[model samples]
Target: MQKKLIDDSFSIVLGKQGLDLAKILDEKKYINEFIIAKKMNLTINQVRNFLYRLFEHGLVSNIRKKDKKKGWYTYFWKIEKINTLEFLDKEIKKRIYNLEHLLKSRETKRFYTCERCNIDYSEENALLNNFICHDCESVLVLKDNTKEINEIKKNIIYLKKELEEVEEEIKKNKDFLLKKREREIKKEKRLKKQAKEKLKKKKINEKKKIKKKTKKIKSIKRK
Candidate 1:
């Protein structure tokens, strides 16, 4: 389900071609651009173009490696799953907000449509035009907004449900990242503690050797 959302976001941003690229890109590791191009049966430039489009949206990231023999650099790309999901979630929320506003407008206002020309006018405009189609010279009938309102309401419900799912995915991703970070921090602290213990033991051993040397010198002086 998360993968579907990511793919949908790619399709929205870069169309079908971007969706194809997203399918091939890895989330865990960076893939060589040349390899991606070969697998996708596209040119290097085409692949780069698609990657750059994703990059602009912070959906994908890349690193460049310099080739010693060729004295040039090659780029590798990877998909940022968390960022992609977040971006999709934000866009979905915006769409939902717009849909809600439209639904409200449909329910509250009156609209008139010209049957012949298929033009829509708000109540004020229809009133100003005297409820007549200026272009077609036909009568402007009051549009039954009930149907339109119902459709808009349905769309709002669907978008809200989708947003809820996307939000759940985002929460999961964030929790996973937090736990991974905590483990890394614990590992680092353990390594530092071990190093400190080793240093403390070495210092104690050095002090013992110095005390033995001093005692021997004092005994020789007494002799």
Candidate 2:
């Protein structure tokens, strides 16, 4: 099994510990729905709805297990890391393309704004309003793109860096799976050895019991 690039279990502090749902789901191979609900401090149905949303995006999968005594089914969830990375890759590509378009617009077109009202207008809107603020009835100032454009460019750069990190995590997951498989194989070998020893011990005990019984019978006959 390969690890996914997106930190499904990745939690980001979105203003005071508000966790990103995608990150939380990405970390576990299989997680119980109830467990997720408890961790998020939400109702089971809320967690189920969120999980279903992720499932629609192909981010998670679930397995249902029936309890023999209770007669109800429990669902266990797992992250689909590969699909998640692909989804993210597609999303980032679209964002980058949009940013490129915005950059071109910033470079080529004139945009105006009302500083007081915090309203922005492109060249067409400004022309329609005769370069005036519609809301505050004030003159529209020529908007500066230097700071805003730079910030957007910076964000694009950061997104690319995050994408690279996700790829690294994917590789890391593959190595982890390989190691786990090896460990399981070793465990199976150990269990087989233990079973053989147990059977050997049982046979020895049986033989001893039979020998003792025969000895008792022969002594009773002599008496």
Candidate 3:
């Protein structure tokens, strides 16, 4: 379910080709762009174009490394999973809001339509037109909005479910990143402590060597 939302989100942004990209991009490690192009059976330029689109949306990230012998840079890309989910979340909310607004308008106000011309107008517009079809001179009929209202309600429900799933995925990704960061912090502290201990030991040994040299010089002077 989480994967579906991620894929759907990408597809929403870049179309069907984005679905193929969602499969290729790794979350943990950056994949070489050339390799991605090969895997997708697309030209390098096409792959870059897709990556650039995703990059604009913050759904993907990239790094470039200079090739020492070739003297050119190679790009690597990875999916920004949480960012994608967040984008999807915003899109779903926007859809729901629009649908709700439409639902309310449909329920409260009346609409008129010309059956022959298939043109729809709000009650106010119909009033201004004197309840006549401007094109065919036919009488305007009241539009039955029951079907539209029901369809809008279903769409709202579907989007809400999708939003919930996307939010769940976002939380999971955040928690994983937090734990990974904590582990890295712990490792860094341990390495620092070990380095401090090694330095202290080296200093103590150096001091002992100096003291022995001074004693030897004092004995030789007395002799």
Winner by lDDT:
3
- lDDT, candidate 3, 1-223, per-residue tens: 8778879879988898999999988888999999999999999999999999999999999999999999999999998888889989998998899999999999999999999999988999999999998899899999999999999999999989888888888898899899999999999999999999999999999999999999999999999
User: Candidate 1 on 104-210: residue-level lDDT in tens?
Assistant: 88888999999999999999999999999889878899999888888888888898888899989999999999999999999999999999999999999999999
**TM-score leader:** 1
Extract clashing residue pairs from model 2: 8-23, 8-26, 9-23, 9-26, 9-27, 10-23
Ranking, TM-score, top scorer first? 1, 3, 2
C-alpha displacement of 30 in model 3, angstroms? 2.1
lDDT of each: 0.92, 0.74, 0.93
Going through the candidates in order, what is the number of backbone clashes in each? 0, 6, 0
63-107 per-residue lDDT for model 2 (tens digits): 999999999888888767666666666666677788878888887
All candidates' TM-scores? 0.90, 0.65, 0.86
Candidate rank order under lDDT? 3, 1, 2
lDDT value, candidate 3, whole model: 0.93
